[model samples]
Target: MPVPVPRQRDIPATDSGPAPQASLTLLVVEDDPAGGLTVPEILDADGHRIRIRSARNLTEATRLLTPDVHCVLLDLDLPGPGPGEDGLGALREVLRIAPRHAVLVLTGEADADRAAEAVRVGAQDFLYRDELDGRLLSRAIRYAVERKRADIAQYKLAESKLRAQENARLERGLLPTPLLEGSDLRFAARYRPGRSRALLGGDFYDTVRTPDGTVHAMIGDVCGHGPDEAALGVELRIAWRALTLAGLCGDDLLATLQEVLEVERPCEEIFATLCTVDISPDGRRAGLCLAGHPAPLISRPGGPARLLPYDDSGPALGLLPRARWPRRQVDLGGSWSLMLYTDGLIEGRIGEGRERLGQDGMVEMINRHLERGLSGEALLEASVTEARRLNGGELTDDVAVVLLSRAAGRTPAA
Candidate 1:
């Protein structure tokens, strides 16, 4: 195991205090035909002695690298007899061997550009030989280590912010307005990412309606968990909305999506499963299509929840060039609810056994919640919470749920 180096806290560089103890050790690499650095002895500003383990070239440097050594001062000019171990090349080799070691280059004053390039390529800092001083050199080493750590932290922060912004844009495009101009049906959704620090995953949803009040809603999951998969999901969701608004539905829409995946996926095996529902204008019937996705669950007021019958739906997108997802129409009583969800909701392992809470188990769990009189947000919350509890941990796969309630003559708010 590699020893962890403690990050040194930054202290103001000035002349009036006792030098901090050199808990850290450093290695200095320079060419010395006369056997040692011709420069004078070095000491910290506070008069604390800085112990340096010196090496004449790459070969000597290799033997001096130890866990305690925290920094390296490499001379940019040195003759090479070893196969690929030139001066800068040797510096790079030292870095590969000791990645956590803060490396400083000792370059000629005229080679300032190369020094800067060294920093860009991962050296902590560069010290020009002609202008070298004991005090400034120590300060530069301290500052260089601190700055490299701070740079890493800032890069992580910026990456997180970029993810949040991307998720916000995706949310706006995927789950837009209900798109039901005059219909009283309510459409609500929630998405949670399984990636540790990401805001979204390969799960997406959207809703759009045509002129005749046929509201179509879709929820899908692209296989795998990553930014690329999430990006692909966003693209597919956008294409779904655009195609739906353009009057594409059923087989045609799915076929177009498969084509999109073939072109957009980073590689093969990145499949996508989807569940879509088209609610009639009167809100009494729904056209359901499943493409290697779980069937939507239905729950009428005062009745147990059950799954909508799913016929031989097609395979997931990106699996086959030509797959057919036939649509099934289901009757919806007034004041009934239907939920479309990704497979992440059911694939979580239950208890310590090999048993996974499959679609049937998920439906049964939802049905029990309904008996306690939970619906809407309450229903979803109770169901998901228990599902997690049964799994004994957070679901590792992305989860997305879209609930559509049709209570025509009497709105659900009643």
Candidate 2:
């Protein structure tokens, strides 16, 4: 049989200086110290000396198996555990100790069956003692190294693909699809994470039309920007939807949601801020509830944008078990657009100064967008984009915004 050829050398060449040659250190484990398993000093195709370190037993082999050792030449006939024990125990031990390194088994010419079994047991290749030579040994070591590298690379590629598929499934479940099929209300939302290339963060929002024809909307923020926080946000949004569909409203709904937060949070210090609005069936009024969160912005067809009352807002969820979120009535005149958002929208710095674009600044920004005849997705996009620009870069927090609009005479009478 023809021997395998070594691949092109990885050593770099230089025009102005002597070329660098590739080199490798190999560990050889055997039992016959008198057989003098010696061969002529070998050099790789690149003329670099190949270093060899010999070990008399598994104990010594392990001591020599440092990070610099690239491959192991194991003797299949080496003595293993006493009678009745696995005769190949030495080989098995080598495999377990140096899993990342390439391995080749050395055996007698008559032991073909045993050599083949060794190959199946993780050896890259098997060598017959009678045919061993410096040239063949060197070529085999190089080939084994390259093969091991290929195996590891393929494993990493498969792992990365699997993770990406899992992330896609998770993102789909986290993002909500509006339940406004029969309602005349218009809905739009935007979300962005501060983490680069991250799919989601702690910010979340949802909107659904109840059986009684009222539209319920919410936007919330968990205190951190991490996968755990994003997961908690998704859990909260799902629970809110389930409760709202079950006829829970106002204080009762908020109270139960706070319980969910307290029970599900990773730690006691973790908390979440939330804002919920239930619009009247006639589309002229709403019941607003805030839990340590900013109030929603409301703008009429001919009126300037302004914030709804936030003075009665309660503590954030998970802050105090007995905290209460009182629902307050607010008149959302006909033909109005109400925008609910997370703190990310207003926390961005206005300029180089330390001042943030607080509630007042955000109102002014929205009014300018409104004057430009922007509405729906266009308006929401402009608001977020401008915030990032004014902050000098992307905001280092999660931003979630939801806009609900109802036109005059568009809804069926309550």
Candidate 3:
């Protein structure tokens, strides 16, 4: 009597009419030349016929194992390729070949222990040859395929989380920390990167008080907005601090930095803009130098803020070989505030239009904030917040702003 094949529940039709179901293919690896083992006709849960292909050994099984084969069924009695006649070696070979595909092992009822061991060796499930039927095989294949997909997804999610944590640690280590101990000048700064979820950008800044009481401060920007550029910026900043502490200043310090930039930059086309200020011990005067960068804004007591001398600035580093960045003398007067910033603060759009808030506009905006008696960190916070508000959104570049202030006849905060 011919055994009747069981029918699965029919899949319902969608609004667009009967949806077509994809067929599943299975590969059977066994040593059955005399038709000793037989597979019953199988149907998927969606009532579609499941295709089956047979191979005599491991070698032939690999040839028939195409990407379309979603599941593999192996017989434990099959001989392995190597000399050792372990009953489960063939199963291991199948697993190595089809790491992404679902795998099943077949064994006799008496060898059920070996079949269970095969499952521990990476097979999705195991089956007894005497009990094998169309309905059971079909259900096992579907479960194995879904389990494999879930495993891959979980592995990828863990990998992504580990990468983000590593990046956070690296970026935090690279950020600058000021060395202004025993200095009278009040220091405050704000930094924001345009790249989403990034802790550092191409802009970098630092401030340090030398043993001779001269406080040196600097802020710079690399030409690009990538990890390579950010790394270059950090290198330049560390180099500057080392040289300044070693008693180098003015043209000599910048010349050495240009040399470092030339050697460390990724390409010849890459360049960096820089601004450096050396405040004297008395805090009434400063030496300024600009390398294709914006000038620092100075605001005196009871007066409007204005830009310092930038007419004698030199070309940006890596742009001109042997270029000279002349240091100009500026009088800050007693009790004044100096603000140094990058081009990101001024390059933001004024509104929905193409017009940008240039240097002149920045001067006016600072003056209004000064009238409101905003100073120190509050002033900086207001300035950056207003800049973003005026741009109608987040600025699309990296911003770094530093402010140093002094009060007449008032002792410096400890």
lDDT of each: 0.78, 0.85, 0.85
What TM-score do all the candidates reach, one by one?
A: 0.74, 0.84, 0.77
Name the lDDT value of residue 312 in candidate 1. Answer: 63
Location of the lowest summed lDDT over 10 successive residues in candidate 3: 1-10
lDDT of candidate model 3 versus the reference: 0.85
Q: Over 4 Å off in model 2, which ranges? A: 1-22, 34-41, 79-92, 108-121, 350-353, 409-414
lDDT of 2: 0.85
In model 3, the runs with Cα more than 4 Å from the true position are 1-150
Highest TM-score scorer = 2
Instruction: Tell me the deviation in Å of residue 362 in model 2.
Output: 2.9
Clash pairs of candidate 3? none
lDDT by residue (196-297, candidate 1, tens digit) is 866788998987777777889999999999989988998999899889999999989999999999999999989999988888877888888889998899
Better of 1 and 2 by TM-score: 2
